[model samples]
Target: MHRRSAVTVAVAAALALLVATLTVLTGAYEITPGGVVSTLFGGGSGTDRFIVWEQRLPRAVAALLVGVALGGCGAVFQSVARNPLGSPDIVGFTTGAASGGLVMILVVGSAGSQSVLVGTVAGGALAAVTVVLFTLRRGLGGDRLVLSGIAVGAMLAALNDYLISRAPIEAAETAKAWQYGSLNAIGWRPVVPLAVSLALAVPVTLALARSLRALELGDDAAAGIGLGVTATRVTALAVGVFLAGAAIATAGPIGFLALAAPQLAGRLSRAPGIALGPSMAVGALLLAVADLLAQRLLSPFQIPVGLLTAAVGGAYLVWLLTRAPRREGARGAR
Candidate 1:
């Protein structure tokens, strides 16, 4: 890694840790920093232990893990598509995962976390298959892949709306809340699954990072260098799909963190290719801080972290779109 990239990753990690510590201290139960420390080390009273260890800590960890998962997925998608707008949020994978979870919530009437997770994975896999089929003829890079993903994502979004509309009133309400992407009900159950998914994904992503970089030079160039272009693209997509599914299963498809993390990491580090490690660190920081603000920003009402991310991400998208031409022009000039 470049020195600046390493420094960016380190700083983001530090900030994420600080924000997570603040999250642990900011809940209604109100443990002091000292109390949180003592409880973490097995010294505080029973109430302190339950509040700090059980309640607050789990939420913090969930935010961090989910952010890491989304961050890595975003880096992979953008690299594969060779487009800045190719993150899962725009590409339909996140929407597909959300649709699956909605199916379990509304159609099957089994809103249990595990059932929802299964649905998310199935839905995401289905979406990946659909995209692969769509792009099989034209291939997986440049405009074709991104356009196919956007079309699939749009259809899935509409399907999600239709399902919500047709559901019973109570179930509809529950489904609507889930659509907002919350970590409020998070526990160790979801966190463990997310961690395991990352453990499996991170190594594969790192191994393929070289191939993905070569791929950025175009498929012919990549293939010329002995990279299995088709195989690498397929593997990267699978990893990205699994990461998106696992994250949505854990936290209901928190928006825009995936879209913005890699772009921001790239700029902060000024790194030429995808800054996967820095992006994950930045993602961890962004989501942890967003969740913290979501909790404390409005006080007693408590906004959903997804809504917060959407609001911020929407603005970021607008800015990115406006500047894209200029950025592209600059790149062409160079």
Candidate 2:
């Protein structure tokens, strides 16, 4: 198992590197990998150097950071919720974060990164807390919790739409870009906060990986083995919120990567529980690939990265619903 795990990690790392390379090399003014490397290292023509270093590099880095944050957060949530269906995308955390972002952009007229990050974190954290509090009475188990999360997500989405409707035409147009998610206007400005947040949160996530494993057991069983169920759940939720909020702040709630990456990692790892390392890797790879497609698919008129992810993620969700087993638990939790 250790050897297999190591091999999986190696393969994921290689894939992430390959995807990053492709993203850098396949843009409009193509450059060889060596040229890309030299341009990044300050040894190329003015335009080539500027495009490589100033334009694409930051976007690539943003994609990688967003991927890691989403993937890691997804694994944490899925484990704590003890449902394969549990994810920010499924439970309304992403929607809440996006709503928070829209509020900052439309109502407050603040498009600053810190303002958006603060609002997004607050929104996502509140949503997570609400989900846990409302669903805990009958115990967090199976499809009931997932169903409640879905309902909350839908409500938050409706709220998002209402806010969009009330805004002025200009604000509404700006919010539309956010709603679909995009990496176009992003630069190094937003990257700093996301890097800091990920630096702090990633360590916490790795340290808690074992606890997340225990969480996959029911709360009672986890408590029996000396885990503080409430504390662990809250800590994990906080990490997830931080990650989702940061990603939304930086990249405008890129859809489905968070939901799909962790599940894909778990399957690839063949682990009984969530796999954080692999999930982060897969998430990074997915975003890199998605961004590559978004940039190249329409030439001068690029598609929003969020739209590409949603299309892929939405299709994956449909496939999941068809494959998911019917639950035998109580319909709604008290």
Which candidate leads the pack in lDDT?
1
Off by over 4 Å in 1: 43-46, 328-334
Report the poorest 10 consecutive residues by lDDT, candidate 1: 26-35
Please give the lDDT score at residue 9 for candidate 1: 93
Task: Assess candidate 1 and give its lDDT.
Answer: 0.89
List model 1 lDDT by residue over 132-178, tens digit each: 79989988887787889999999999999999999999999989988
Clashing pairs in 2: none
| TM-score attained by model 2 | 0.93
What lDDT would each prediction earn against the true structure?
A: 0.89, 0.85
lDDT per residue as tens, model 2, 1-334: 3455456667886888788777777688867778888887778899888788777888888988899999999888788778777888888888889888888898899999999999899889877777777788876556766787788889999999999899999889889877888998578899999999999999999889888788787777889999998888778889889999999999998988988998888778887666888888889989988998999899877899999999999999889887654333333332
